[model samples]
Target: MSVFDSLVGQSEVVERLKSAISSAKGGSSSQKMANSWLLVGPAGSGRSNAAVAFAASLLCSESGCGKCRDCQTVLSGTHIDVERFNPTGLSIKAEEVRELIARSAWSPSVGGWRIVIIEDADRLTESAANALLRTIEEPETHTLWLLCAPTLGDVSVTIRSRCRHLQLRTPSTASIEEFLLSNTSIDSKAAAFAARVSQGHIGRARFIATNQEARSRREEVLSLAFSLTDIDSCFKAASKILDIAQNQAESENSERDSQQMKQLQDAYQGTGRSLISGGARAIKDLERGQRSSTTRSVRDNIDSALLDIATFYRDVLVIQSGGEEILNIDLRTEVNEFAKTSSPKRSIERIEALLEARMNLGRNSAPLSTLEALFCALK
Candidate 1:
């Protein structure tokens, strides 16, 4: 298998990257071999995967022949020369960029190139971006920077202009369904359901296919359409939604938080007294970072729930308009009944309300209040 096999529905991108790899290996003065690259795509569009694959290709003797040890190490993030930066906090600070810059100056430990993959390049603060800009402008001979972001607009013009841009499109529903069925144990029906509901996100489709609890949670969210009858019911619905989102976020982050704390403690362990003079301050900083990470996780979980709610209304609108293709095919009976009582106009308005709630959350509004207002509008 090739390294690009997992990049579903992106044949053109795969071919282009393969050509670049071949050109670089041939020692040709080609534009395809760039010192820095900006990978722009929507979430779950496989930007990070593409970057990893490219890194593997650069490190591999056979140009990304997927079965090699070098390919496996790079893809699994165990390669010494491949450094990955995924911000756990709200932003990437200047200090982090400075450290990366210093690391970039080092020659590769084993491979021909030292690859730095930044998963959320858009999270860099202004100072951090400036620091990164210098490194990108005057990169080391054997250094390659691979930055992934949701869009080109997320990065400053200076950074954008200095890097070669690669764009990835969302996979088709059929492509996702096929991948789910082939790679996972899910049946065709479940695969189709997950694919349609995920709206072309491969990770989400796989999650819904493999996780029964996620499917049940989505069903419960869709069922809320039948529950929003009165003001009190709306408030209850909002509270329930927030509670579910928080629970989901905690479930996802609790184990990670515990592991991070343990690592911090182990790093600061000493023979006697404190590990360092300012051990307490160090621990406090770690805790602060954890809090920021948890806040972002909870907000992300809440936004996902809001998207589910919006998609439910979208299904309702589709049903009301006699559209046969619905995202939530498993909830067709209930959606049909809901559509019978709800007008297309009202369904459209409900979707708008959910979008507004998402926007409010993005602006750091109070989650409970934003959700309550959303459910009230739905009611």
Candidate 2:
């Protein structure tokens, strides 16, 4: 399938990117298309998908024909003309930005437009952001810099002001279900269920529809808001969340880490007869790095699910407060019970606590502590 097919309900963003590429190729100097672009949106709102599609368009023969070799390579992330930086670590280090800048200096080996995509521009360190600013300020012809961030507020004004803006919105349930049915073999009922539960997140919907285990986990998490009765219950929920987060992280990453460590420890005879030795300290350091990275990833991943849970409770609070149009009604029964016990004020305070916890994580605080504090505050 074409890359654009994944970005449902983002026609405005698609049109903006298409127009920018068209203007750049049309040689109509009368029209203005900025060198850099900041695609702002909520998580799972097609920001990165739009960026990838735009990069594909920049490298395509007929401006994103979807059938050309350039388009195929870009979509597959093997394009010589296109480079994507999507680090999942704590920060985008200066060295990484320098590498991207160095790569930008060279012409595309494939003799097409060179596009750089910073998938999580919000994760850029201050030094890395400054380093990126140097090239973005005075970009070369045939160069495109596309940055995807959660919000305009997450990015520096210096970078935000320099780029053209593309804003994407979450897709409607109908659109999400239709896309899932068209793209995947998931049954219609399951697709609809996932669409409703995931709250417009295509990625999370796919997860919910694909894995029974994931569905169970989400079910357990959603049921918590209703059963939370006392401070002890809050602590129980927090500890349970922490356990689930850590276990899921281990399940996802431990196998790879083990295999890597095994390979590192294995004896190998090289061409130069050089021995590969990873000492105890080196191995420990590697393990430490992996652990730290995994911890952050796990926290963020868990936070995504928690945000949905919080949304569910927030909707319940809104319903109790006589607010119209409850946003997260997929768990209506559970929410109804939650609204029955907790005053609207209480539920709102809990939601605020969740948001504050998320903010703390964004600021590099420990997730375990932040989560504990949130539950305690909710209590």
Candidate 3:
């Protein structure tokens, strides 16, 4: 198997990267093996996977033999020649980009190319982007930069213009279902359900299929459509939604924070009085970072919940329009009930409300109030 095999439903991108790999291997220079590339794709479209595959192919003497040590190391993020920067906090700061730049300047120790992959280029602050732009403008001979973002417009024009751009489209439901069926032990029924409900996000489909808790949580979120009957119910639904999101965020943060705190303490050489006194500032900084990460995680979870609600309404719109393809197949009864009681216009309005709630959350609005207003609008 090749490294690119993991990228589902991106044949065009895989072929393009293969051609680039061929060019890198002293084949026809027609593809003009770029030193920098910007990977633009929607969430779960495998932008990072593509970047890592490309990095592995470039580093592997056999060009991405999936079993090679080079490929394994690169894929597992243990390759000395490959550096990745994926900020868990809100933004990638300038200092972080500067450190990456310094590392990128180093010659490859084990491979021909020194590759730097930034998973969320959209999260780069202005100064960070500028710091990166200078390096992209005049990159080292053996250096390669791969930046992934949700869209072309997310990154500054100056940086994007200096790099070759590639786009990865959302995979089809069939593609995602086939992937899950082949890679996972889940049955065909579960695979199809996960694929349809995920709305083309492969990671989500896999997670929902394998994780019973995630499926249960999603069910609870989607059930809000049926719960928004009265004013009291609406308010209660809002509280429930916030609690679910908070719980999801907290569940994700606890283990990661514990691991990070342990790593910090280890770096400080102990956990006694002197270590605590010397590491107080670092501990505070880590706490502040954790808070920022938790805030983002809560908003992300809430946004995901909002998307689930929107998809339910979208399914209702489909039903009202006489379409048979519904995303929420499991919730067909609830969808049909809403469709029978509400017009297409009302379903559209509810979807708009969900979208507005997502935007308000993105703007750091109060989550409870935003959710309360959202359920009221849905009602």
Candidate 4:
């Protein structure tokens, strides 16, 4: 098995990586492999997976044979020569980038190349990007950088222009369904439902397939469309939607937060006065990071809820236009009722409202106020 086997709907990218590996091995200047790469794609389009696969292939003598030690270590994130930076907060700061640059300058210890993977390079602050730009400009002989972002425009132009860029497309519904059937125990009907509803997000499709609570939350979010009949009802719906998002975010973060706090406490136990003082500061920093992560999680969950709501309006519009293939086939009765009662123009307006709310939330606007106004407009 090749390391690229796990990536669905990215055959072209796989081929490109394979070619780069061949070039690296053959030492051909005519097809010289890139020292830095930018992998851009829609969320759930396997950008991160592609980066990891390429890293593993580059480090492996056998070119990413799945069973080899190089590939296994890289996949498990234990390889000394392959470092992955996943930002837990909203942005990657200059301090973090500086530390990474320092570590990346070290020569490869266990592999032919030192590979650094930054998962959401778009989150880099200006200072952080500038710090990183210098290294990419004068990379060490065995250093390779792989940056993943939702789009090329998300990264600074100077950095993007220097890297070999690859774009990934959303996996087709059929491809996603096939992946689920082959890799999971989900039944065909459930797999198809997950595939259709996930909007090309592989991780979301798998979660929806396996998690009862996720499905329930999606139902509750979509039900708000019918509940927004009057001013009072619209307010109630807005509160309910926010509640759903907040509850999910808190649930996802609580256990991880506790675990991290416990580990920090354990590490600081029985230390001297100076070390304990340092631990206190560390704890405060950790607390701040935790809060940032929770905030990001809540915003992401709200955005996901908004996307679900948008799908309802989308299906309604499709029905209004006499289209048969709708995303929410399970909610056909509700969709049909909505189609009959609303015009395509109204559906379009509601979708626009959803988009506006998403943008406002992204801009750090107050969630409750944004949702309240959005619900009113949606009504």
Which ranges in model 1 have alpha carbons more than 4 Å from their true place?
A: 270-273, 276-278
Across 27-95, the per-residue lDDT of candidate 1 in tens digits comes to 566554888899998887899999999999889998899889989999898999999988877688999
> Model 2, 1-379: lDDT tens per residue?
5557778888777777778877877756789667788998888778887888888877676787788888888888898878898775777788889998888877878755778999889888888888888789888776889999988988988888888878888889889888888878899988888887778888888888889998888877767656566878887887888787788888888898998777656633333333334356667866877876797768877687578678787788777988756655566666676677778777878888888888888888877677767777866
State in Å the error of residue 305, model 2: 2.8
Superposed Cα deviation of residue 63, candidate 2 (Å): 2.2
Model 3 residue runs over 4 Å out of place are: 270-274
Q: Is candidate 1 or candidate 3 better by lDDT?
A: 3
Top lDDT hit: 4
* lDDT values, one for every candidate: 0.86, 0.79, 0.90, 0.91
TM-score of each: 0.93, 0.88, 0.94, 0.95
Cand. 3 TM to true fold: 0.94
**Candidate 3: global Cα-lDDT?**
0.90
Candidate 1 local lDDT, residue 105: 84
Off by over 4 Å in 4: 27-29, 270-275
- lDDT score, residue 97, model 2? 91
Best by TM-score: 4
| Candidate 4 local lDDT, 104-201, one digit each (tens) | 99999987899999999999999999999989877887999999999999999989988999999999999999999988899999999999999999
